[model samples]
Target: MSSNSPSSPLRVLVVIASSRPGRLAPAVAEWFVETTRRETERERMVVDVVDLGALALPFLDELEHPSTGVYAHEHTRAWSRRVADADAFVVVTPEYNYGMPAVLKNALDYLYEEWAWKPVAFVSYGNTSAGTRSVQMTKQVVTTLRMMPIGATVALRIGDSIEDGRVSERPMLGRAARQVVVELARVARALRPLHLAPATDGTTPGPVDGLSLSRVGEGDDVSELLVLQRSCWVEEAHANDTLDLAPLHETLADVQAWAKTWTVWAVRRHGRLVGAVRARAVGSTWEIGRLMVAPDQAGNGIGSWLLAVAEQHAPEEATTVALFTGKRSRRNIALYERAGFHLTAAPTTPDDAVLLTKSVAATTLA
Candidate 1:
């Protein structure tokens, strides 16, 4: 996504889990801001630091268990809301004698479903082990919470690196922080569907009536279809550094011709078009293309649902499915991967297009 997209920003919540005076949380947060500013030019994301020390959240104590849906305490409910609203998280922590601090653990323990399907990266500092213990322990907790823990981590050994309560030699820390931010951004975008679904009794609800799938045709609904295409192309143009409406308008004739030979579906929700997919039988393969969704309607499992429907409609003689996306569309690439497509080749154009394909049984039923 382009940094300048005029949508609601991707919210990054940096949680400072230390309450100690003169601690390294501020320096760590600064490092994060600096690194992220340089690495991500996309203005679509906004990072906010949540200082747990300043919040003075009390140790967990309640009349009921956290998993029981009885969060009576005001702080617990407020914190849970904050955690739920965030798209991604970074925990800045200090190692306390080979374990994460009790305060941090308690903070995490106060919520259950709020943390699921999100992405988390860590910034740690310590004297001996450099908070490696805290990182490991925190990973275990985050895994149980079902959040994706990214590969990048920042660890600072503060023995000689701290001068007058300020971090010295920040270049290394900056690099590490940048890596964490980039990976977190990637994973966060990948997990958007999982994160955006409404929390139920621990299960995602089946398709609702307004969100049902329907085939697209000349006589079929076209209003929502046009909106979805417009939104998707707008975002694509912004991210791929191309002229808006050029590829889309140019592809109209191709799209119409292809639609004649393909089964196209317009995904609708509440009587509005949210997404579209076209699957055409090419040789022995079912070529899926023009998979687009409204920017506001993305991250809500609509794309996956449309893909599933398209797969079910593939011709019985089809052997595989294939599609292409721009190299800059990292989110689309990851989604296609999750849906069982594998990268087939590098980009042949200057725009660096990525080709992906998925194998299917030739005799499979539609």
Candidate 2:
């Protein structure tokens, strides 16, 4: 798991949930394999794909609870093993009414811990929204299972890209696919250590002392909160090997305003301001905007402590908690994944950051 060591090949499970023959999964899967082979070969990483459509998985409804570790059905157990064995996953799905198909959701629900601590990406296709809604919904569910969904999603808009039952390759689509592959590689590399870490017993730890979670409001810690902002951006720069601090300072006011409306944790270590995290409430969902720890205190587990406090505070109101990180912040991204945030299908535009989220009530802490 050392960053410098020659890591094992990445076992990728490509789930094609759509049953329709002319659906976009074939083209999307092909694109993923082609692009992934090229990029992984350059990195000396092996890659493999599993087509779920060919697995013939049945709709979920059975005699046993997945969380209890008893899978009664044969197909369910097989699917669980497939999921458990893989190093990462890529879900090729077709959008249906601003959400993913029922079959896909059912497949995911069939297994709990088998999917934990792994990385996932999406290849989505649909009309107007281009499966953005489906991606959003899927992200919430995956996070509940403690999976790391890396930024780098491929979304294909219908009509403009389909021809005679085949999805014609657009140059732009290929480029996006390549980007997703590259990002997935980075995420897999980052999570390898955690994947190899010792498993935790099923017990949630108590919240840290002096760090309480409350709804963000007036008179809360502001300057103390600024430290998190600085820490996240500084760490982001260091991870990327860049030194631009302008964006870190420029977004202060905006982030502060965001804190006022959402739940923000004031992380006090030994009764002194050290770090903080601010999550904004958007509709029924909450997005974590600023999660930072003082640079000098990062490895001391302050960030992880703050994140646990925030998750405990998030569940009663919001359906999910989402956040974005810089593509280059390898450590931060892995930390977020370990905390149960999953990546969704959102293009990482120069200004549009990488998005990650977890379902509030659906996820458990251990």
Candidate 3:
């Protein structure tokens, strides 16, 4: 999110909220982006435009609601990714019978957490109301989804601000557009910490910000964990020169069964499952398995922190903690080594993998 750095260029997604033929939303959105270009560049902001008309999203067709984020269709997934990638948003719209457009509402209803902890601004054009009513109606819905709507807005009078179906090049509106971008950037940076999970009563703070760790439960967490496993082990499959990694092929049922037996912990960022590791005590040794981190989050020290969490929860009677990885997974090996684990003679280990262990007494397992 926010281009890998909280202080990096702000990603502002401008949404064109009208889908009707010859709609003015595109022209309005174009004007907003162009007018704000100078301030955005000066403030290290990046602007991207999304046209609801071109996107052609149907009325909330997914069986599961946006709250679950279990997107069943490709369109929903694509939309979710785009929204999640942005740190802020701007909507350009026209009044629809004194409310927001149906297309805009539909697009907003397609995802949930992706909209959380971000700032949004609006530019509205209409007859008597100048689309201010539409903006008010949208703010209610966006607020319920956890988006922060700024005070800075641009409301256009179609009768005065339009010439030839486009916004007239007016200095007043250009200045207003700049204000919207500036206000959005300020609010977004202020709200950035809300996206991060600081220390909680029972949970230890992670290495980086925005991490929440918890035991795996019977919910969408299992489904998401199953997905994370398949994704994180692609490198393991490649390194071992085989597609035979269990994590790469484990089904939902397999994961569910294991959760019933092992103490499985997961790491979530903004409600997305980003990393996980599971372990169980076996004959004086705590056997840790299935260490995983989302590909984009692999280098963020999440895997190491998750390992520490597993160790911290290990049975006190266990003498050592152990895990296994593909022998060629040098990255994983190196991480374990730095954590004070080392390879040992594991006669039961599979041919393509090696067992690694660290004495529980030597670790901070409290």
Top-TM-score candidate index: 3
| Residue 33 in candidate 2, Cα distance off native in Å | 1.5
TM-score of each: 0.53, 0.51, 0.60
Which candidate order results from sorting by TM-score in descending order?
A: 3, 1, 2
lDDT of 2 at 293: 71
Candidate 1 deviant stretches above 4 angstroms: 1-8, 40-43, 197-366
Q: Between which residue pairs do clashes occur in model 3?
A: none
Q: Is candidate 1 or candidate 3 better by TM-score?
A: 3
Cα lDDT of model 1 by residue, 110-185, tens digit:
8765677789999888988888899899999988877788999988888856676766757777788778878888
- Residue-wise C-alpha lDDT for candidate 3, range 188-264, written one tens digit per residue: 87876544322221354554566677887755489998888898888788878899878878899998989888888
Candidate 2's residue-wise lDDT over 3-28, tens digit each? 11225566666777676665677777
Error of 2 at 112 (Å): 0.6
Residue 81 error, candidate 1, Å: 1.4
The best candidate by lDDT is 3
Cα lDDT for residue 174, model 1? 74
